[model samples]
Target: MTALPHHLDADIWLLHMFSSQAAREGGVIRRKVRDVDRIVGRDAFVTEMRRRGYRVYENAGQFVIFCNREAVRRVV
Candidate 1:
């Protein structure tokens, strides 16, 4: 696959890592949105995930993202 833009690397990587982990363990991926904003704006990061078929939510101070419906259902 083609590489993501430099500014989006960290955000995408974190999303991938959490999604992978969640897919395996049926858990939600909770991340600090501010951290993502440092590399790519929080809105952009969230938009990217949404575009990729992931669900994104802001709870407390973090972004909760999940790839699989089962994972999301389990977490919720």
Candidate 2:
């Protein structure tokens, strides 16, 4: 029912976020699910992350993105 504040496209915002210093250094990035869905639909967000070879996990209405493409293993 309301318009978003920023005019940037979903893809552009994603690219910019991924290109941030923290991401470039392979740091983890967290984003709110509602905001991402508002700016970039859930499908688009997941697709883009997959396209960029990033690993994402959702918990508590937030998404945790692993910036690196390194292999992930479960050690438990």
User: What TM-score would you give candidate 1 relative to the actual structure?
Assistant: 0.55
Candidate 2: which stretches are off by over 4 Å?
74-76
Q: Report every candidate's CA lDDT.
A: 0.67, 0.86
Which residue pairs in model 2 clash with each other? none
lDDT of 2 by residue, 2-74 (tens): 7655656786788788889889999889999997998999999888888889999889999989898987676
Q: Candidate 2: minimum summed lDDT over ten consecutive residues — where?
A: 2-11
Stretches > 4 Å off in candidate 1: 1-12, 15-20, 23-27, 69-76
TM-score of 2: 0.80
**Model 1 over residues 9-40: C-alpha lDDT tens digits?**
77566656655856557555777777677656
